[model samples]
Target: MRGKHAPRSTRWPIIILVIIAVILAPIIYGASSRNRTTKNQTTVSKKTSHSSISSSSSVKSSSTSSLSQSSSSSDVKLKSAWNTTKNKQLSAFMSQWQTEMNQTYSGTYDGQKPDYYGISFPTALENGRLSGHIKFDNQNTTVEWSPNANSSAKNQVLAVAVGQTSSNGYNRILYLFIAQEKQPKVYVSQTTNGEDLYFTETQNTALKDGFSQIYNSN
Candidate 1:
């Protein structure tokens, strides 16, 4: 009887331990599960933040590139327009003068024939007056002249004329002419000597006025 009672008491202690373990098992498991969920949520949040920053950076880069391209395109368009307008004005002035001069001088003068001519826009001006260098050149010679305030001819237009002279087998010679609005005398110079020479233009008033208008507009 003593042995059987001792065995039964030992069995009761073992049963109580089993019952406590069973009650704590579910609580421990729930705590562990919550810990795992919290860890996962934290990791996902970090990844989302990193992705947002990368996306924002990409958007900013794209915007900057677009603005740069737009600015470049605008500059190109402005340059093109300027070139077009310049060519048109130059063409009109050349046509008017060439036609008038050709009609006036149909014959050669002393074995000298006018070959071709070109007019240049004023490089520098002050207070609507020419105050800079006007350059003329050909295959052989290049000449430049500066007009100042004290210059007898405060001209705005510069014309370079090329003519063939019979001396030395029809050699080419260059002549420089300057003119202004309502001015009867056209300032003249040659490559040989850059001196003050003038010729009166009683005719071709329209040509002079047209050239003056172009210069002033510029």
Candidate 2:
């Protein structure tokens, strides 16, 4: 004889519950994983958007700076081109020097060669200060000189030899003043003729032309 078994319907409910749990496990896990992937994608999209905005701003700023620099350069050139006062002043200054030399400048000997005058311009007008040189055509000599004064520095001898000379071609003496106007002075002076120290005040002359040439055109 054997013991009696449990009722058949009591085991049916338990078997059905087990089957339901097995099927739903994979579906629940899939749903949870899909939700996490969507969240990650949103975060990545935000980062990309922020990076693009920053890059665009940098490019815009660089382009703006370049445009500003170009505009500034153009303005400067335009200003220089339109400066009329300096041109007129420079031309008159040259004329005055030519006139004075013809009348007052004397040579050491008779029949000294005449000087040819030409002007040197600065890169910018900068108030029209300029330099020049005089070529002594007859003597085959040239001197780059500018107007000087008693306070001017012609004291140092050219070579410890007697520097001052009366020859029109050598010492390259300039009028102490030109028309009482401010004169352009160069850093250095040179002459192909014999060296001369500063000329006496008598050798230097001034006119009322109200303009002075700036420097030696050596």
Per-residue lDDT of 18-134 in model 2, one digit per residue for the tens?
A: 999999999999999999999999999999999999999999999999999999987764444212353344445545654655533422111222231221111111232221222
User: Largest lDDT belongs to which candidate?
Assistant: 1
**Per-candidate clashes, comma-separated:** 0, 9
Give Cα-based local distance difference scores for all models.
0.44, 0.38
Query: Which sections of candidate 2 miss by over 4 Å?
Result: 5-19, 82-218
True-structure RMSD, every candidate: 12.7, 13.6
> Which residue pairs overlap in candidate 1's backbone?
none
Error of 2 at 146 (Å): 28
